[model samples]
Target: MGIRSTLPLCAVVAGTAALQIPLLSPHQQAPLEAADKTKPLINSSALQDLISGDRLFTRAKKLFDIAKLGEDEYNHPTRVIGSAGHEGTLAYIYESILQLGDYYKLDNQSFPAVSGNVFESRLVIGNSVSKSAAPMGLTPPTQNKQPVHGDLVLVENEGCQIGDFPDSVSGNIAFIKRGTCPFGTKSEHAGQKGATAAIVYNYEKDAVQGTLGTPSPNHVATFGLSGKEAGPVLEKLEKKDKVDAIAYIDADVKQIITRNIIAQTSEGDPNNCVMLGAHSDSVAEGPGINDDGSGSISLLEVATQLTKFNVSNCVRFAWWAGEEEGLLGSDYYVATLPEEENIKIRLFMDYDMMASPNFAYQIYNATNAVNPNGSEELRDLYIDWYKDQGLNYTFIPFDGRSDYDGFIRGGIPGGGIATGAEGIKTKEEEKQFGGKAGEWYDHCYHQLCDDLSNVNMTAWIVNTKLIAHSVGTYARSFKGFPKRTSSVASSAYESEAKYHGSMLYI
Candidate 1:
């Protein structure tokens, strides 16, 4: 899925006033400079203090300041792609990179991106209205269309094939399970069965806002429901109960072209490079502070601080645009990179939502059956770091749901971290992270309220430190990861013992 909605949503280590980030044009490319090879590359301890919660907060305030500005304000509140505020965001990072001067070579890869919105989504089950109803992305406008009604019919097994629909489904609402195929495919099948509307329940988990993948007349206006919520309703229908429902969706469809920023160290092994990424653009509704700004700003702070030392392996930092538009920017960057250049990337780590009020420490599960090779090592780096702190952590699959989607598809080893988003927190998680068990991880997920207050300070601070821990360790030495045969590093070492050697917090 493209950067998801239900979708939702960094910083530094000091006084942000001390940052003398130089401004650079969006299209400007900084010339590469020779690295002063004489300076020794700093180890984890040499740079630990630099990754400060205070510092992270300082830089994070800059983004909030930008996002607080009104639409006409110089730094607009919403960093929607191509918006003035988004431009402000780009300028901030460009300047941050430019501040490093000769330390990194900068490349601004621009792409034509697309995005749209489901303007209104409403539902009424019997006499009660549902506040949880949401329109599937790419759902056609219901403004000029007929409202959905009649008996709700349950479709079997993921509803991928036309046979899943029965004669009774015609002229009714199709209740489908989310599995096997794209949401669009299921919805299309419902239409093929003559259903006026479609409701796809989350087969294994809680309710989620989903995309139909694309627009199609074959699709009936679709709504995603959670299994917990659907179980009783399904049982009632099975008992031959009369359950009437309605589904209405209207949308605003348009497009915008955007770019992804890529900056690389001037020094270090060119054959083997470590890549760090975060989405720079927010969703259509909110400022996306925790969604990605936490990750973006943290990387900026780290990049600026990184100039203070040298690195044995090249480190590349990317601020991806149009991520909320389905990871468009990152996908475009990967698709266009020459195959030879693509092979040069030794590892890719993505950081999307680094702050959620009711947060869970999520590390992408790289050892899972589906993950690409080397992904496990990337995940272990953070899991081990969290374990050392005696903190509880959980796994998030590196499936194609984020900016890392493209890299994983291209066979590059990739993994990432997320605080949490629209998913409801369980009681067990509540005991661990401490917040309302039934509430959304980020209550304001994909909404205009996903601003400064939506973040959990403790989660924000800890994750930022972990990011620095991973970046600094990899930049100094690949260690636990395989050194490319193309690189000169002769010996392979493990960082399991030295991973936290320099951190002051732990």
Candidate 2:
């Protein structure tokens, strides 16, 4: 509950000159080609010469190398909040933008985020142990390593509602099956029932993994167990045999301030800005290269290459921190934006997990009525983009998951692309995007294996090129896009923001 911070965030210069630039890492040694430096201001077709699969792959490798340094030097491998890897990633991105000269106004808005890391955590059944078990995101460390043991009590299929938890679950661990609710809600209900702890088993084949969405006093300490682990615990309990279990969770929670890197072209109409954003932090496990490194670096490279161009409408790029921690960075930015500042956003775009290993040509399905007025226009833009390339594309609903949640809530039209996450791919999706069916879009979605090799270079190249195209298009014109409104309330976001009983996000 250590939440408030009095420290003023470091106001990063937006489109400002550099004070000092860090030396590039060894892996980031590619020389700026003569064409790269002198490339004339252009429209979207310039993507052909500026970015390619090879370049993106090489840059991603360099990003992985940078992530490695966090493990080697700072002892935190992944780019999670307050980790060395995350700090380094931010610095690398900042330097990349600073190197672009006077092309954009550069600003780093630093703010405190309630972020933490697990020191030592575990969940073990009386017999079989699932190494894949992960602590929920943003779990407070109060229950550190103190093993809580109980006869596993299985609530209804989903222990989401207070009524779903039985009175008998009091003084025991509530073994809840996950569905139809936020993981935090399940934990909150079980805790309200006087349960010692809560264990949420995945409704899907994979292990249950996700955050409580935000810090809540009502939520008790909880751990995620795989379906494999939960099945046995339930079976043993059903057979009247003792199904004893112990869960150990320890984390250090602190109010740590992180930066949001925002850079915008100076020549364009500042009153009407087009925004692009991607989270800069990873999870607690590996160097979340593909989970976000691909997206983060995609914007970085595009921002660098964009320096040669003159934009008509200001193009603002943001590298947000604390997305894996529940979209805190971007959420804070949007929530605190002044009336004038909020209205300037012509439209907002988010790019996250764009290069999942088993990639998909997925666009945010803003075509639905749940989205803001102009979301469909953004969706159509991406549909036309992939269709023009003869690529098979599909629509991913505009759920309040990812960094765009805040923008959508601020009444801004939002759309972006994703390459899928932990969800399993159907045979139909395989036919559409062409990878092994039945496999997770990113086999290493949030695990330690999400390293340098996790990206599908084809997806990386195409999606980033699409980003370049969008930036160039919007940077030059907002002719067909929806006009900015004065009000800041988003009906779609308000409907979706209180995700009390939704089980779809992490």
Candidate 3:
């Protein structure tokens, strides 16, 4: 959850200045040139092998089509490591990987996967107190459902500062902002100040409108409130007025065990690795088929197929558990890695939601601001592949919204493909894509309706095949990475925006 990589790549400048500026010094340029010259290039044999990998697709479809998985099955819930849902999902994935590994002769290892979960809490507003609200993921579960009523402490900035909480906040719930610093930090600070609970309001600058923050590690319950709702409470707190509010942060959530499924090629060395990962967990409320079932199936097929094929790159596959509960499995895996193992990861391809009936395929471009992620060479290679395939995609910045966040933060090159979700398509995009501009890309994105029946098989299958082909291409002949381009300012974004129109939150 903390920031991952400390390695600094060159920052990208824009327009005229960037064009005139040289990125490397004379000495660095020579090494870079020499490295590029010695790198391998993709060969036709690998492409043929990838194209012929039908067994992988068959297996992937089987898992994706099956909807029996609950949060702990193919789809994980909010449970992190040690939760039944988390553990169950992990166990299933682990079994799948073991099967694939044994069949393919790949050396696979299982490590401890763990996460924090809150089991209890108490909220008291005025005279009424009840444990009706459960803290969100990464927030601590309430220690006691004890009713604690006092003046509500509203911290204006997302970061808890000196004046944010007064002494009156003792035995009170502190409301904090969700920008400037991580929500977890602010919540932890409030808890250190003897605050009973924390409510994080979404930052005004955030495009995603919601009051969101991490839970307290010290078992402090945290709630996310909208800016509209938190504003008045903050105003009252600033006035030093006594306020009555109900606070209950308790849940039946319990600790349990979980596992991560992994499969690798027998011929490859673990020292140099290529990882492809996707979480098999879903939100607790729904089946989360498209949210990840699509991705799971895609990777399953890819991994299964890899077991049968012979490739030069050491490829590994992972089906993570507890992704719904704040990336527990992936986080644990990344955190436990030795420095060398972490750096040996040449690329990490994350497939979250690959097939959506409503949205066109959208690739997570590492060059996007949300990610500004991975090695430049990795992104360029993938981008070039997309172009060659004539696939339609929109590049967004890296925001650590998925499992790939861990690898990306660690400075590994990461890129994945996703189809549209809730975002509206622009007019220009509509012209290109020919869909209703302001409709949800996948109406069943996170609901039970997201079963296999809701997915567009053509899209799913095509995209899955594309992923296999792309990965194989990279595995066969990757050399030095491509030049990094930071802060890609696209002239086409406006045109695309005009076509898609504004997002409609239905």
Candidate 4:
């Protein structure tokens, strides 16, 4: 298929107010409210009511604080995969749900993922050295930890095609602007043109934190520079001035084991499961509170509240890891799952960014789905909820930019909501959503500033309510929802699918 496309609890851990997470048990079961036969069926209103902004914020704060408990060698405050922060996130989710007793079956599915850690990255131009450079994820490090020294040659037209690289680029560093193509593609093109390295600068003011999708033989060591840092070099190049530079990136890219938390309601029919997911890991730069901590905590709140009632269809919640690097955790789960188990999933909903400060109620536009089995219905359900609530909403393409990509590729219909991401809010959206038209939905997205202050509490609560509504509706019944059928082969999506986050588009 081608797509287009926190409850606060305070606990002291390591001098930080982290969540009071308990030790994980292989399996634990205790009687909960779902056991009573007289319990009422889950409804949207009830489920939504259980979602408290105060509670959610509390939890979000705790998650942010936990990220401060770094385990990586750098020990920065990050919840990136293979770090203590991520493990703490997993433990917190397990302990939170454990409070619900035996209502759900929880499992931590472990897998190894190739994670890239950039030890050093910089762009040295004349006497000016900018250490604000970051290596694109999954990109190869400079050979022998050596810097690539060459004259900076600006690639024309965003450097998406071979023609963009001038003959003068041979043995030089390709100075490219980010847009229109994957960073990998640009790097590959630069390598093909005999460029010693590629330096892709962001179009936005912020530093470029992107991925090359995967390692490629044609890719040379690549680095990214923010618009501010690259401005002087760009001005010099535009004026036809000779700008010599040194690009260096020392990174360690290796496969490391991580785990995904999968929990399903034990009370419902497992044959027809309504699945929801949010990435548990953050980018290495910061605590991913708004990026996905909002979504992760939303699921936790919903799961805890759902213990009050039973469901007809099983509701499964997943905290996927390695989402920031790529959709590695969810992809691994879908790839390893047996077809018999796979077919049992009725629909999958992904909630990635739920609380962009300058937010919009953007639902996943399932109309562009590669496999439209039950996707539109899922989208319409959220749309209908928004309409009923008298909220203005818009659509974002199903561009295989989130965790929903794997399920949709497997012919399982998928849909969900997002506040928004790096996309600048348009004037029309501004009128509809009451946010600044020219600013990014979340200005702090993927940056160290994406901490507790980055979130919009109002939008977070509303989006969480929407998630509850959708989860409750699907859990109660699948009436009128289309049955799963053979979708376009997974191979069909291989060519066009974008594995990176929402910011990068084909």
Candidate 5:
């Protein structure tokens, strides 16, 4: 996921004139700072103007209505994870953005039609022999669709280093423990070891719910197993007894279509454009309401709110497809953008899973605990925005785990906010967030139960408001998301020196 692209810093600095932004010192409130000296913050007249004008909540409702396009009579859409059903959802999202573009009079960019291949398998593993097995994602269909058996060699660390399994791994299938790397990496390594098949076990003590990577067309098949289901098999292997396993994967490789529906606010100063984005597609099992419906809805609301604003800089919104499939849409979008085009991107804010049924706001690890994947400036900006709104949160590293992966790789300063996912709530977090210690932030995460009814409307509304505020503020704030500063207040005057006039249009 590492971005190989570079920004044209020298060219940008050399060609653009600097613009000044009004300062809001440490004592100034963000809301107060937003009001011009002549305008009253709560003036009945201004309130009336805005109320009659485009309001965020009004726009939110309109967007909510659009999101209901594919829903059932009960307003509950069965947006199956990774199925053809998503096409209807995608069409709904596309038409919504197109309408926003028409409303805003913006030159919305159209993403090229997506062309890829996918194979969905309905796997049923019978415990006839009582050995653990589950199909992995992106796995290729079997040549004969016949079952294979072999002694399970418990490979440690899942690294699959040549030295890790020095003995001949040919013919015999390899059973690997998941960890130290991605499931895909482990599967690919097992294929290299001449493994006829691969069975990956859970790295955790409890359940092994990790995703398996797609296997190469020429490589052996791969499967994953829960810890409980795999323990006895491991026990037998430890006793030097041969383990028997059967894998039935209905894998097929066929071309698939995906897309990134993009809508931009009217072009203003090019160099200062801000991007707001969220993926629209979910895994092939559930209606990704929390996984991304939250973010997508927020973007729709923001797009509607900004529809009439005479912004200093342009704002763009994107509803990406294939994010759950390793961020394919975003990555393809970034990779295809020209160099000058890429540099014009001042900031990117991704809103993936912004709300959960159980709301414990999980900030992207901007602390860079795991990697330097976050923009320090963007992180601070987001954190400050949250603090001003009096929201509770935690900061983690970028993790290269979502659609932001593409933007971060491209060096376009970007950051995002996410409600918690599969991560367990610790005793400390439970005390702070008022959740059960043993429970996860979203129990129905990636499950069919993750529908709109389960969503915490209060948290959803607040998060949407915050996202709107951020996009609106950045649209009119100094140049773009700047590098993080200990005192964001101090950076106001320095804005004049920082703003690089608009970049050349693509």
Candidate 6:
């Protein structure tokens, strides 16, 4: 299927530095020779055998290195959308798949998106100027970078609902505690209440690096504060102490062009397609090796191996962009597909953040009321695979935080796997996964420290093997897989669409 878009291109906001790394170096191996048509159909064991942890780590390290090449004075090594690092990542995937000859049909689905980054932020409370202020991504900057001076009004009960923003918050700055809803929702509500700006403080001791999901007219200049930085301010407010502050965020928010890389096997039944995807872009804070680099590399490795054999169903792999800002690429892909093309996608599986340091084999729980009917079957496939391997697995909610959100809402059956991210581990999980309890599954999640060291090689390889098993099994046959139905639960779509990012649930 071809990519047809009516979206107009805009001026690029981020620089595209040329990738200095060679496409095929000594360490970067080429794709295996084309599959012999006479070869046997792909099997789970054979596919699983092709997954190598050493190879996975090598490729992941390559991606990290590419990210570092894009580093600038204003930003860290990151593959955030529209940056040079993400462009290099796109080139690597495209060139790698091209090496396999015409075995797969590649599509460059181009679209426009609003990319933003915070360069400088400040929160001044009297003479005490806190330069540690972190601006929420995609939120508009202070008008012309001028400081917004107003009384700091503490929002009641997390500021999730409109009523939580008191009338006094009008013509002032809303000091909100982070939790229960999206940062975008809080900012939107604050703007609705006529607040000039908003400050959201983390509930934990860690620094806050959050997103407003996407640009909105209702949003005001929003910033994040660490718990420690906001503690005294909160105490003073609680004691009815008069508090006035100046908030300023210098950010570059503008529209830019980005594309999604989609490749489908040329030899399989086009009418029956098995799809797999992962967001290829990282958050601005770091290289994002564990957050999604692991997932992206897993798909690349599996795609490379799949060329050795033929299949009964078309296998489509996608590397999505604009996922860090929100699930923009995937959402656009699903929305633009013709109804005929959409129905051909029998199943869509997502793999994201597969290598948390303190990992657990967590499969998406598709039994939730919001998910489509056939999603449960996909979940069972993963659960059975983990059981066969004698590995313990847990269920994470199939919420609309990732790329799968768009597919499920469009009535396609979707499911996938993840290790974990930012969520605290339980004692039972520690016993099962052999990791510390009461600690984050990924300690360096969305931080500059989320480099190669943050990955769990063992867990990553195991998860990659599972991906191979699922792809091979379904490619051979879909005898027990459910057929696509015409109708979807409307209420389900409404519920799922409300979620924008992973941090929203927290």
Per-candidate local distance difference test: 0.70, 0.74, 0.54, 0.80, 0.56, 0.82
lDDT of 1 by residue, 159-214 (tens): 88999888899888898887656777888888878888888876554655777654
TM-score to native of every candidate shown:
0.78, 0.82, 0.71, 0.80, 0.72, 0.83
Error of 1 at 428 (Å): 5.2
Best by TM-score: 6
lDDT of 2 by residue, 1-506 (tens): 11222432212322121232222221122121222335444587885458867777777777787777668643646777787778878888888777776676667778888775777877777765657677776666534447777767778768766998889788787888876667878888888898877888875567766677667776777778777766766777767676766777777667788988877765555566789999889877779988798899889888878877656556789999888777888988988887656777778999998899888888887743676567788888888989999999987766677888788777778889999987788899898889989898999987788987788888888899899988887776666677766554456555555431112442
**Residue ranges of candidate 2 with Cα displaced over 4 Å:** 1-42, 72-76, 119-121, 124-133, 141-144, 153-170, 176-181, 192-194, 201-207, 225-244, 486-506
The candidates, ranked best first by TM-score, are: 6, 2, 4, 1, 5, 3
Q: What would the per-residue lDDT of candidate 5 be over residues 287-325, giving only the tens digit for each residue? A: 667777778777776675555455555567788777765
- The TM-score obtained by model 5 is 0.72
Give the per-residue lDDT of model 4 (tens digit) for 212-271.
876677888888789888888899999999999888888877779998887777665555
- For residues 1-506, could you state the per-residue lDDT of candidate 6 as single tens digits? 23322332100100100121122311122232223557667777998999999999999889998898668732679888888888888988888888887667676788998788877778887569865567787878887888889999989999899999999998899999998788888999999999989999877777676788767788999988888888888999999898999988877788999989888876555567789999889887788998799999999999999988877666889999988877889989988887766777788999999899999889988863567767888899999999999999999877677899888878888999999998899999999999899999999998899998999999999999999998997887777777776545457555655456554523
List candidate 1 segments past 4 Å from native: 1-34, 68-76, 143-157, 163-174, 190-196, 203-205, 217-220, 228-245, 368-370, 387-392, 423-440, 483-506
RMSD, each candidate, Å? 10.2, 7.9, 10.4, 9.3, 9.7, 8.5
- Which has the greatest lDDT? 6
Candidate 3 has an lDDT of: 0.54
lDDT measured at residue 393 in model 5 versus the true structure, 0 to 100: 71
Question: On a 0 to 100 scale, what is the lDDT of residue 194 in model 2?
Answer: 84
Query: How does model 1 fare in lDDT?
Result: 0.70
TM-score of 6: 0.83
